[model samples]
Target: MDFPCIDRLEMRQRDLMAGPEPTYEKVVTGYELFHDSTPFVCDHGGVLPQMDVAYESWGRLNADRSNAILIHTGLSGSSHARSHAKNSRPGWWEKFIGPGLAIDTDRFFVVCTNVIGGCYGSTGPWSVNPATGQRYATTFPLLTVNDMVRAQFRLLDHLGIHKLHASVGASMGGMQSLCAAALHPERVGRLVTISACARSHPYSIALRFAQRQALMADPNFRRGFYYDGVQPHVGMKLARAVATVTYRSGPEWELRFGRRRRAPDQPPALCPDFLIETYLDHQSERFCLQYDANSLLYVSKAMDMFDISQSVTRRLAAQREHAAADLGHELATTAAACANVSVCMNIEDQPASTTGHSQAETEDEIAQDLIAGVRNAKQPTLVLGVQSDILFPVKQQREIAEILRRAGNERVTYYELDAMYGHDTFLIDVVNVGAAIKGHLENTT
Candidate 1:
């Protein structure tokens, strides 16, 4: 009668421990990882350690190991990108990756990692900092997209994956995918950089700044170290609310929600009125519940600081990968390059390479150019984008395609469409999206 494995006891425990976070993260079937170094030392003195990574796998890796497809998540997303075949709740990327879906299990072996600084079971401000024997909170060092990619590299190594068919993602995830291909092209055969850019744009920076201010403004926000029970929930919500606006487009919001009020006849207050409003509210609520506030702030900044042309140039100086390399190299080597990229924003009144909320601006173009050195990458690259998406627009996807084409990349393909839901199309319209992805990867010999 006192057996601890009793359903009643376990159910109660689940309710008590689970609020909004992934309570079963420790043993989720598809979600797994290699938890090793958090302090993945970077070029800067800022040491990025103290991390736990959550990951999910789809399909089976081929004996050759080159069939593994890597997926990177955008801001606030974890490794639970799709639902298991029979699972009730649709996985985050169920549309694009599933048994018969786009990134089909029948064909490609897929791997997705919860980036460092992520709160979804991955080490973040919430995880106890080994150095301090307490949650790092604000005490955790600043992180970058490179750190995330590096961590993923180790995970790939742990999994015995020698190469990937393609690496893809949207928004920040898109940024990571790009960085991965750029830095480790040899490790990945095909590169799919969806709604992202070679560098961060000013509009993106402005949007991120608005979101970050919401968190720091909260009195509970303790710089980057508020792990002690007190969390900036309101700030995080506000940030999400703001970001929700950007993740889609004006036309999309109008078409989908279109000012529809909620709960039939109840006046609008703290509750949502329209179906889209309700949808955003649900996502934000779940996000605030599961995702850590500080981790969001830090990761957002990491995306902002993600340019690497200098390092890239040095890496690929011996041989050019393709025109993607030649153009980027020419740009980085030109005076106009600074103006075209690393824009001079007056808001922070700092050099583009030193702006807060502007990881893209601060990005060393050299680091980004490293993609040029890779020779004979075999993965098929597929870049998908929503027409109305403002966050990472179809234009951005085109830029990525151009880069691949310029690289003399024969395995690259691009698709841009009218997913009226805007940036969320990839997440929402998975059937169509996934089907497209599946078709392309499958059709190829």
Candidate 2:
């Protein structure tokens, strides 16, 4: 008797050679945060003297400020989550973020920020180091999902957004959204995680390791300091090509490409004979043009190291019942104060609040609140999984939903999309994704 699971695994192997289409466009933004005095500390014990975070906003902040939604981008995404006056090209999530859409920009003030270690306007390996007056390159500190969330918190603080109606993300962005809720649960009233997990699976780790090796193998890599000269484009392209395979499912490749040749007239002697080969090449070429090799390495490492289970376990171990209650009360009070304030980005140059507490002190309080909130978080959460996704399998999504339900969150919901696009379903199946999100948002609101 042929087992269904065995058949599915075989199909996955067959389509493993195929690659999905690359989709990322440059986002134009006029907002940036410059944090020079206060340093950002990384989990791996690395510190940056100063940092800059680039971001973009959509729609207006409601009077009560209860309609704010924070969107976390995937590994290759920039702060540009949707179209604006300066950017005419569609954003990565343009379909679900506009007016009356899934995210409903007309009713919600949406914010998307480039992660700190991103190659975009954010301070990454491409950014100049104040001490050396050169790009950080290989010297850039290792980052974690929490580190990325911390940087975003700074941006939110600068914008005077103390609470989010919902935190939504897909892929790496999904990872960030989970991190944000886990790290600062009180600040996030709802959570939507799609095609992501609490930690990278071993299979994903191996794939990422292969991609990193390809980049380092390039002679032009020069230990990631190639900005002065030739870049390791070849290796970067190879890495992208490898990654594209995991982003799609085997059944998708079989159905879409079907072992077809690029052209019936093409000679077999020429390279890239299969249609799938050309598709991967196109994806690789597009990615190498827009993304930095080192940024890929840093972000991949961050994803691999993310383990929310460990974080939750540690916080629970350190908590005192009464202290947790006290922290929760303090968080509610401070969050109200933060929500009521209307601070502008220009306030970066101004001194700390005149309320007697230093900026560091205020941040520390917020951090503590976030940790305590995570321990007792009971926010409504929606976990979406793509049925064919290999990178972040449906099992992982189920685990996320299960964890939240077991943690006493009564309103947790789980939805699995039966799409053929695999991990790319979040981007490709906009209608289904939007409908589910809209339904959840409406029910919660």
Candidate 3:
């Protein structure tokens, strides 16, 4: 829809454009490896000679540093998970965190960080490469879920947290939490993943692909090298509006904005005449300039490329190829690969079934591989699913629980919530989501 009445004067004054670097220094407490000499290697062979990680922490670490909980953020979340001394403003997950909240800052030390491929106080495509003295932009290496989780563990190591009390996350954060458990089972004592998937399903991938297309189609995007030029405000706005459709359910939308017209008697125009359209426009406008367009593209692609079963299959193949490889040693190598070093892995770009295997066979093999991957994650786990969620459907949550259980995790606690907010139930329905998390954290058995 054309918004011809947006008041270009007001838009010009607001400068509805994001700069190439992050301006969120106040939101982050400190960096993890700002002065370290060791380089961080990516899954796709990208190297950061000296990386910096922006992170925020709440509460205190015990003397032995055992009462720590690592929280992962969704696709666009920042390091500020809650308000603290440095930043008094409420954070994205403020409702779910704080003293006596679901995360219970009074009893646990909660740490959250912006993923590397992010724009919020973290090194992303917007960051200037020290090697070339230029913004990575479109030249940034491809990222995967494993790469993001590895960065988080590096921060954990910096905090001297050898093991976590629980790894917690929702949405994309859920994928990271699950990866942390499967990839580094010995370091994660417990797991809590909400509204997550074991793999990037085709439906979610297609939705994200469409969002990227909308963003890249803008002339201002300039193929992700829009630095020193006009930012892709139009593209980012349209992409966010498209993503808003997948974040909630049809029933919720119908209930909230059912045939509601901005002006019931006014003639329809190309502009937003309906309440839902206006709502989407407002959301898009608010988000369009707050994030870097390039970072969004990179992070979305990483989410699309995430597949937990691939780790399992790769290990099994290694053991088969080398009879001298021991199970304990292989697990250690996998943990190290997910820590700070690269596994030298590439994105799985081939079709799902190409070895003359039927679709059913491929599906079963992936399931078995996922089960094998999580076999070492025997700690107590909690998985929550929203029935109305179309993005990461309830079936995906069920699959995580089933795989964990089949992998011999007897302490898996699965909950199927009937919230109307769809995939965002964990973020909105705090009462139900918090209760489950609180109970899981408090449960000793």
Query: Relative to the unseen true structure, what is the C-alpha lDDT of residue 436 in candidate 2, on a scale of 0 to 100?
Result: 90
Name the 10 consecutive residues with the lowest summed lDDT in model 1: 338-347
On TM-score, the stronger of 1 and 2 is 2
Candidate 2 error regions (>4 Å) = 1-36, 311-375
lDDT agreement with native, every candidate = 0.65, 0.74, 0.78
For residues 1-445, could you state the per-residue lDDT of candidate 3 as single tens digits? Answer: 5565366524743463533433434334443333333555555554455566778889999999988999999999888888877677788889989889998989999988888889876778887766567776776666677878887888787778999999999999999999999888999988999999988888998999999999999888887777777788788888999899999988998999998999889778677788999899889887887888988898998888777775533643343334223222433342343232223122232113221223556777878878887888898999999999999999999999999999999999999999999988888998999999999987877
Ranking by TM-score: 3, 2, 1
- Per-prediction count of colliding residue pairs? 49, 0, 0
How high is each candidate's TM-score?
0.75, 0.80, 0.86
Error of 1 at 365 (Å): 11
Candidate 3, 353: how far from true, in Å? 15
Question: What are the per-model C-alpha RMSD values against the true structure?
Answer: 11.2, 12.8, 5.9
**Which whole-number lDDT from 0 to 100 does residue 120 have in model 2?**
74
Query: Whose lDDT is higher: candidate 1's or candidate 2's?
Result: 2
Better of 1 and 3 by lDDT: 3
Per-residue lDDT tens digits of candidate 2, residues 1-445?
3354345434533443243311122324454445634655455534565778888889999887888899998887888778788666678888988889998888889999888888778888877776657777777777777788888888888778899999899999998888788778889988999999866778888999999999889777888887766667678878999999999988999998998997778556345668898799788866774787888988987787666754333432243233334334332332321222221111122222121223455644533433443455578889999989989999888877766666667888899999999898998898899999888776744
Query: Where in model 1 is the C-alpha error above 4 Å?
Result: 1-30, 37-39, 48-51, 85-89, 263-283, 308-380, 443-445
